[model samples]
Target: MTGIATSCATSPTQPSGVAIEAEKIRQELAALTALYEERNNQFFSHLHPLLEGSAFFKESVQHDFETFSEIKMNIKITRLEIRKEDVWTSVYWEGTWKVISDASPLLQSGQALFIFSAESPPRLMETRGESPFGVFQKAGTPAADVPISTRE
Candidate 1:
């Protein structure tokens, strides 16, 4: 019994599968956000791997690059939950974007939900709510009103 107890104490507790997946997704998101702030060519390469060639993602990112001369995003994962085959994370983000033609930077902050597939090295499947990715179009459609569906 003492030997059993000692072995139990010495053995490290393994994290649950969900916890491990969540951490991987969290790290991926952190890297993605850092790349977004950098706004370099490497951001595109890093982004496509995380998103798995999402057309909507490509369009939104392209728009941001064309419209903004400078952009900065600070993101915090507020909550992580698993729903069916997807892992959904709620993110609180603050951002500043300077339009290429504008003199002042636009500052915004909001919460968004990011859904990722449950596969190993999970891919971002969709984004809802106020997207950290630039969802606001030059047409003046509000971010809240922008449809969340992936149009590809």
Candidate 2:
């Protein structure tokens, strides 16, 4: 009788490159969102490095801090498009914002687009659409009442 030996090697599974990148972006956004909710001094420091020095963004953040005693944001990334260039990635996200002030908390939901830089850790380049920070600004303003002309 003859004896034969066989050996096999197996390695643990790892996430794909896209999955890793998506998770990284998600984490970065989540951390930034938490800072917004905290409304602490550290929020600006954390935000400055991530943003592409948009004065409007800074002002919006300041306005939000002044407008709400507490802000809670729940962000869900709906789509992520990645590229290799000056424009790294674009994230389409929907967020539910709950703002608390002297009055009862106001809840609103909206979607926005975030453009990131091509750096290793992507920095926010631009933001479009409805943003969580400006919910109260829009809410507080009264809407214009314009009449439409009808053709007989």
Candidate 3:
């Protein structure tokens, strides 16, 4: 982060640091897809040097390592927005993942917000996701720590 040179917002036509950072995240996702397929640890470098993904992220990775002999993932960025006043970025994305041993491939998608400090890596602040099976959100419980209503 410290190494990132500050760029002047000279023209609307020119890309800003936010754009460049988002692109870097895109590259990381692509690399992660390849790494997941290969079950390689080298993908670590591609992630934010310090990542604060949701509990689901940790669980999903652990589940993959424990349950799957082969795994594949694909992340697509549908849209991204970055705020200049703050170090936060919001991304809307979709993804598909499969457990090769399972009977069918699994598809999942989500929207996430990230916080990036000047010298530190970006952190995944929160996310809301849905899969073929259910929905997930990275957030606190409702008032009084009650579960959200499942009723329609």
Best by TM-score: 1
Tens-place lDDT per residue, model 2, 37-116, is: 87765566544243525555565567777766777788788778877742333334333333444566656666666665
| lDDT winner | 1
Tens-digit lDDT track of model 3 for 19-133: 7677655654456557756656554444333342333444444455554455544445655655552244444545444445656644445554434333334433333333211
Each prediction's RMSD over C-alphas, in Å, is: 4.4, 10.1, 10.1
Q: How well does each candidate superpose onto the true structure, as a TM-score? A: 0.72, 0.68, 0.47
Whole-structure CA lDDT of model 3: 0.44
**Ranking of predictions according to TM-score:** 1, 2, 3
Candidate that beats the other on lDDT, 2 or 3, i.e. the better one: 2
Error of 3 at 42 (Å): 4.2
What is the lDDT ranking, best to worst?
1, 2, 3
Clashes per candidate, residues 3 or more apart or on different chains: 0, 0, 0
Model 3 earns a TM-score of: 0.47
